[model samples]
Target: MAYQTFRQEYLQVPPVTRAYTTACVLTTAAVQLELITPFQLYFNPELIFKHFQIWRLITNYLFFGPVGFNFLFNMIFLYRYCRMLEEGSFRGRTADFVFMFLFGGLLMTLFGLFVNLVFLGQAFTIMLVYVWSRRNPYVRMNFFGLLIFQAPFLPWVLMGFSLLLGNSIIVDLLGIAVGHIYFFLEDVFPNQPGGGRLLRTPSVLKAIFDTPEDDPNYNPLPEERPGGFAWGEGQRLGG
Candidate 1:
């Protein structure tokens, strides 16, 4: 019964978030068990090009350092925010969500070439947090019971916390940067006087991931709820 209950709860997580968090956990477990070396998963242009090791591009974002506090911290944020976004704004829009992932990943990869950073999972988490916060700006937030603020400040608060932890803020900044670009293009710019949608999901991707209207499981909600409150329910400790 206990196993079944656990399984049920696990199955409740959104599909993309579930798959992503599972990959991160399993990747870390593989490294911790000595089944794989960390060197193999890091981003390397030479390995990707000369050696044709394309897996590194994707794997780099799957493994955060070996199972430790930082790993746990990042995983929590990644899973929480990613799931919230998936079930919230991006709900019923699987293809759009996937497009966001592709868009962010592609931008991050391009920027990674100029920066010395590898393993972009942290940055990716920030991007998720950024999008969630922006879409739910009126939602109140409390950080570690010490500070209170609105949703949009979440990313900067996280960057500050990262600075305090002595971890580089560059990754967090990068996530925020890319996230803003996506948000502006997708959400902001499109609403301008003459602006039009810049991020249209490909028809093939939509057909593959989106549910048909006739499907019983298909349900759609307004982009923003009528009330000032956001439908998401979760607690954020810090960052």
Candidate 2:
């Protein structure tokens, strides 16, 4: 009965979010089971180019260290923001969402070459949080009930929190950089005078994943950005 309930809820998650979160979980579980080592999953440009271990490009973003508080925290934020983005901004636009994934992954992969990050799953999560916060700037949010700020500041707050834990800041910075690039190109630039969309979703992707023909007249649903108010030291960051 418990398994059935879990499966039902899991099946209800949006496709992109479901796939990503599931991949992260399975990768972590595999590591825990000793079926795969982080050494085999982490990013290595040399291995990718020389030996053609192309899977590393993706597996790098699928492991988030051994299961612990950090893993739960990242998974919570990742699932929440990623789902909100898909069901909110990218509603009925699966292909475009996938394209954004491709674009962000590509940019991160290129930048990862110069950085010392092994598993970029946390960074990728930050990127999702950054984009979601930017799109819903008016939303009120609080961090662990100690800090109250607007939505746009959530990413920075997370970075600050990570700093407190003594983790390297490079990962956070990389996420913010890539997220800002995506936000500027997709949301900011197109709205500017005489500026057109620089990141067009490829037709092939559309044909493969989704199509305009799916709906002759499609209206976007409301943004699923979280909104609320609370007092006390809540571990989660939400508004």
Q: Which ten residues in a row have the lowest lDDT in candidate 2?
A: 227-236
Model 1: colliding residue pairs: none
- What C-alpha lDDT do the candidate models reach, one value each? 0.83, 0.83
How accurate locally is residue 221 in candidate 1, as Cα lDDT from 0 to 100?
Answer: 30
TM-score of each: 0.89, 0.89
Instruction: Give the per-residue lDDT of model 1 (tens digit) for 46-71.
Output: 99999999999899999989778788
**Whole-model alpha-carbon lDDT for candidate 1:** 0.83
With candidate 1 superimposed using the best TM-score fit, by how many Å does residue 1's alpha carbon deviate from the native?
1.2
- Residue 237 in model 2: lDDT: 41
